[model samples]
Target chain A: MENKYHFACQLIREAGQFIKGRMTSDLDIEEKSGFGDLVTNMDRETQDFLIAGIKARYPDDAILAEENGVTHDIKDGRVWVLDPIDGTVNFIVLQDDFCIMMAYLEDGVGQFGLIYQVMADKLYSGGGQFAVVCNKEPLPVYQERQLAQSLFACNSRMYAQNTGGVRQLLDQCLGIRMYGGAGISMSKVLSGQLLGYFSRIQVWDYMAAKIMGEGLGYCLLTLDGQEPDFKTRQQVMFIPKAKLTEVLSYLKGVTI
Target chain B: MENKYHFACQLIREAGQFIKGRMTSDLDIEEKSGFGDLVTNMDRETQDFLIAGIKARYPDDAILAEENGVTHDIKDGRVWVLDPIDGTVNFIVLQDDFCIMMAYLEDGVGQFGLIYQVMADKLYSGGGQFAVVCNKEPLPVYQERQLAQSLFACNSRMYAQNTGGVRQLLDQCLGIRMYGGAGISMSKVLSGQLLGYFSRIQVWDYMAAKIMGEGLGYCLLTLDGQEPDFKTRQQVMFIPKAKLTEVLSYLKGVTI
Candidate 1:
């Protein structure tokens, strides 16, 4: 593995363990924009710890994190995107779906990705050139499953509002699951428990998963079939390539 | 507590802990009747455990459960309605929203209820003369929050249908939360986390929560404003009394 990629994995594992250790303790959880949006003091503290360690070891690398925003220069052609605690709500509620995620971009291309499911102690990580690994074992790109045999992760409101798309997708799939946490939903896809997932998500939500999905030979694309821009928020869908054509074709027919 | 009610609580607590212990372990998950329906070995096993224990202790009691159908004879004086694993999908996926739910009906009237959030280790139980309790502490009916300031739990598909009184109810709430599990969603209402919850649900799904909500000074009513039948399925809404009046007025104006 590349040295920087290895370093990123090690940092993510450490951060994940740190969060897990505090999962059941009293957390300083505060409402953010709304009841649905929450932030914990632990989130900020973890971000600070990771950022400081990364900056000290790699002074020239660019960093983008949930807290402290972006720092360092981008001209170095390598950037680290981090979400210290991806499912803050789950963490606050003492639920176990929360995760720590990291993605490394080199020369404007996603080179490596890591997602650590804290409570389950499962780490999914890979570089584009290397096979995806789960708990140190290689995880192959999932084989194609028919929509009637596959499970899709989705959010309730979005799925309901876009009924035409959802119905079509549901008709083709074995079932639709709404688990309430984006990181864990995507992790299900990565772990082969889910065949695909579609959602209107923020950039931070997609960063790590997109890289991991692509590295594992799954197709991660914008719903509109455009190249996904890492810097801007977008609606994205990740599916195995064989299922992609069918899903996109079905979605195209929907009014939304 | 009545002797029967006390026994019910003990059984629910034990079953809840049993389910929690198995949350992350391998489960024999399988589809039940259709796409949206799922069944697990744990679901059947839990149901059997509850049914056998109930029968052994109260030999003459009529029993109803998700897996075993109905058993014994309805003596018109006492009946036990049970959903051993209320959110099978949540349980199958190891999501934390699943619960062990039970309701007792005396002369076809709900007399006792229990909804145990196994992962959180919180049990919401009550009915008839007893006040609702969370972890054994009585919870007062929330009287301060208005509809505009409270969260509401709802089924996503029902929200999309915009029918059966949900359209009017949706306009009166601060926001809607779709957690995908009826037992888990109603537990939130009993705990004051949600001001109310309305969905097209079966009797098995609402019996336990309905009993608990009523004991907590919340209103559990049908959309059409009729008494729920323990022997039949119905669409129900469980809401705090103050909000119920506001929601009823809103629904009347919609003319549905």
Candidate 2:
């Protein structure tokens, strides 16, 4: 586990460096599903680099990555979920606020996680036996803040649709913020920069941050009341455990 | 003018440094107008420090600032508009994504501007005879992009109200972002990281970025078509010249 954790961190840093170097250059950007759902050449290249590094070390580990999807089923042994670049739109447009995320789950439990904010050069890594650290500093323990006293992040779609009383929830919270990426947004929550995040996210998006955040007393919930698995996308709330009931009451009618 | 520009830059950096140092310390946070609109002791201290510096260097200049409001009416020989800490909420909570902004106007015409992103250590300075420079590097000239090609920043209130067909406008654009502060959001637009910003803004909030942005061929407009003065809070759009007519079409019925 120790060796794997160190290897994951190293590979992520190298991938981050590679992505950082390409930011100023021309990107071969392509639309994945729609206009705003952007994918760039750097995304593919970075994912291949991380997957190659992982395969070389742990040949039998199943890899599920954003660009290429999963290599195999998550039945047993080790499964690595990767989002080579978490905020692809931000990467293509701003060259900032995006992250490289990877989570290592063994047989079904999360064992290790990493989210590297490339431009800022901040690496949030931990889980398994290690505590989450931002670069060299241990992330400060966050207080459990109430729903009304803290800022919340709700993606524009949720806010626009007023999904599950999102508009009402925003009115109750201190304010709303939109970061455009699950990795960076959840990172903000884990670091106590934000009170919590409410958005629809995939397994790759929430897995790494969930592991690190839960270790620090944060909570992750699927709004639909189904147990999260490595398969489906769901409306999830990553928040302080104390604010769970309060936030959920507002998001009651929200589904998917 | 050169001396004042250099002086403003020096004073802003000093204030930024002072504010940055105090971020990790205890903050006396208070709500100003509503729950989310916050003010802090640091905001007051930083404002006082900047005002004192300006008085020492340019004693006759009229100073209009956020914390203390205007020193006097703007029938000016020279006026300095200052926002000691532009994103007070962000400063109190996230401790990032806030800026110290100042714009120097001579006889009501923009003469100099400065916005220091304290945590990032980025100083965007220019105006009068100087072109905008980001930490000694001249900002790259941005091409005018169509509304469909850009991301926009809309305050939560505006988006929720669908004010001026904001919902329809958001649909046509690539995406919507909410940055909480006028300074950081406008800075993103001025730097090409965002397409434009639309929100109700006071004089000090838009003065600095407005000066710097206008010099770069960007345009500022009041959604109500009113000529902006230093006395009123108005709905404004800071965007590329090419996007004006197109964006205005969607916002036809919107009035602030």
Candidate 3:
């Protein structure tokens, strides 16, 4: 397990360096679903590199990568969920604010997670066996803040749709931030910079950060305050346990 | 004029260093208007330091600082506008994503502008007499991008309110970013990373970036597609000239 974790970290670091180097070159960009849903040549390249590294080390691991869909049932064996470039738009436009994220799960239960902010070069990693860490430093203890005292993040889709009382939640929090990358935004919540993050995201988007955050005494739940189903794309509120009730009260009559 | 611009730059750098040094210590935070609107002791201290330096060097110039507000009207002889600490919420919570901004004007005409991103140590400065620069390097030329290819920013208030067809504008753009600091967000636009930024902000908030951006061939206008009044807090769009018509078309039937 330790070897797998270290290998994942090293692979992510190399991928980060690769992305940084390619930023100066023209990115071959394509719209995956529609406008704003972007995929770059680098995303595919990075995913392949990471998957190949994992295959070389742990040949039996089931992989669920962003660029490529799942090959095996995630609940049956060791699975690695990967988002090669979490903020593809940001990566294309600003050449920063993106991250490489991966999570290791055994029998569908999360065991380890890693989120590497590419430009900042900060790697946040942790699991049930060990405490969360950012680079060489252990992350600070999780300090739960009231909704009004906390800065929060939500996806623009949610904010635009006013989904699940997101606007009310915005008014309740200290302020709002939208970084366009789940890894970057969720990492901020994991590091205690943001009180909570609410977004309807995919398995690869939230899996690593969810594990890393839960290790820090945080909880990720649906807008209805239930455990989020890991198998489907869904809305999840990643927040401290103490603030759940208050946050849910505002999210009671969700618009979407 | 050159001496005054250099002096402002020097003073802002000192303030940045001071703020960075004091970040690890207690901030002595106070909410000025309500929950999200914050003002720290450092804001007052930084403002005083900047105002004092301006008075010592250019005593006859009228000064308008965020904390102290306006004393003499800004339309008079050479006026200095200062937001000692922009993005106070970010400064308090994240210890980053904030800047020190100032603009020099003569009889209501912008002369020079400076925005110092404290933590990043990035000082963006320029105006009519010079090209925009970040530290030692001149900024890249601004390119005209279609609304579909551009990332845009708007204040959370406008977003939540869906003001000026804000929600429609969100759908048309590539993505949305809310950094909670006009200086930080606008600087991104000034550097051509973002297509434009929309906000209902005050003079100190947009004045410096407006000058710096205009120097780069960008224009700042009201949501109704007119020049923003310098005397009042209002909805303003800071974007390039080629994008003006298309952006205003989406914002035609603004809710607010």
Candidate 4:
């Protein structure tokens, strides 16, 4: 647990550079279960690189990653969650929504979070007393703005399922955005490009992002008004405090 | 009709730069008709800039733009259809997907197409024997690719209304992408990132994109298999030849 925050930051930067180096070259993308799910060769390579780095430095720590799944149990006291590349579709298409993500947890409690914009070389990292930093400059968690004034990042699949939620959210927000990557979408919220983001995403997708968001005083929670379990996937919404109150009240009236 | 292609390209670039310069500052965005429709101050400014530039160069030509509507007759031998900022939502939020689009119609037949990605400084322009060019480099029109190997772009709104069409299309394609902007989505087809893009978009949103897409050998038509009319908005779909054949056949079987 010692220096976990610093360790996460270093690991994220290294992983990001690994991804950046492989961007322009050909990628071997394969279908995972369905067409919507994809895994690239770079995903495997970066996961291996990140896991190896973490295991070598913290031999007793647990690890979780998109490719290989969880390697150990949380009882080990320290655990790392990783999404080597969040937007494989964007990467395959050579678009800009892709990102690298990492998070560290101590006894099941998130201790640090990091999400890096590989192309932009911008890293968002924070936990506890440390403020969220984008490329080393601290960024304040955006204060809750009016929904009509806030930009939102969402996934189409999730938005489709939560039509009522989506409509309600959009009715209040300035606009809706679909970038196709949860990590990148969450980073927008952290960086003020979006006031909030809601998606039906896995733990690995939101682990690192939630850590950074919480550190910046943003709210990341299940839409059902419960704490997100790190072991399972859920429909979650992350919003600034001002929107949180309004959104929560609105969601309460509508039974999902 | 004199130098119409060259004039369209020049006007698009100039309008693109004007929009790019305005992107640095905050935009004044307002709802147009519904929650999904949007407009901005830059949209108006870019339109004004385009109209002025076109009028100075070709006073007798007709003009059609998003904000100003039809400024002259369509029978003026040559007509210019302009979308000052094609992805105004993207422009207002991400400041990226927006583009300056212009298409020239000579006697109601598409003669030239130009779509400038302002932020990326990339332009797709072509007419007649001139090959599609991206930043002056000739871009290969989409190769004859099968649906199983090609990526497709369609918005959630369109997907909802045309579920059968979308499901059939998705069943045949490698994947579906929701980029949230018709112009930006269509650019992918011209650039080879997407094999095609199908969506219910306005004439202003697709006119210039459709012209550029045609130059790239991508077929732009209504979803029910008809030619798109310049006078009205339509549910359009642009597809590479092989996939277009496959999808059109599939659409024929599905009851819309």
Model 2 earns a TM-score of 0.96
Candidate 1 per-residue lDDT over residues A182-234, each given as its tens digit:
78888888877788877766666777788888866687778866667655656
* DockQ, each predicted model: 0.17, 0.78, 0.79, 0.32
Off by over 4 Å in 2: A253-256, B254-256
User: Candidate 2, residues A119-223: lDDT per residue as tens digits?
Assistant: 889899896678988996788666766667679898889888887677776788878999888888989987888988888778889889888987787777776
- Predicted structure 2: lDDT: 0.83
Q: Once model 3 is optimally superposed onto the true structure by TM-score, how far is the C-alpha of residue A181 displaced, in angstroms? A: 1.2
Interface RMSD of 2: 1.1
DockQ-based class of model 3: medium
lDDT of each: 0.74, 0.83, 0.85, 0.75
Report the C-alpha lDDT of model 4 over B193-242, residue by residue, as the tens digit: 88877777767777776766666677778877687775676778877655
- Model 4 per-residue lDDT tens digits across residues A31-96: 886766788899999999988988888887788778855555543577788888898877776456
Candidate 2, after superposition: displacement of residue B113 in Å?
1.0
Q: List the residue pairs that clash in candidate 3.
A: A164-A254, B164-B254
Q: Rank the candidates by DockQ, best first.
A: 3, 2, 4, 1
lDDT, model 4, position A249: 69
How much does candidate 4 score in TM-score?
Answer: 0.87
lDDT string for model 1 (B111-162, tens) is: 8888887776778888887778888898767666766555677765567677
Give the per-residue lDDT digits (tens) of candidate 3, residues B14-88.
989878778888888887877667899999988988888888988888888789555557778888999999999
Q: Candidate 3: TM of chain A?
A: 0.96
By lDDT, is 3 or 4 better? 3
Q: How does chain A of every candidate compare to the true chain A by TM-score?
A: 0.91, 0.94, 0.96, 0.91
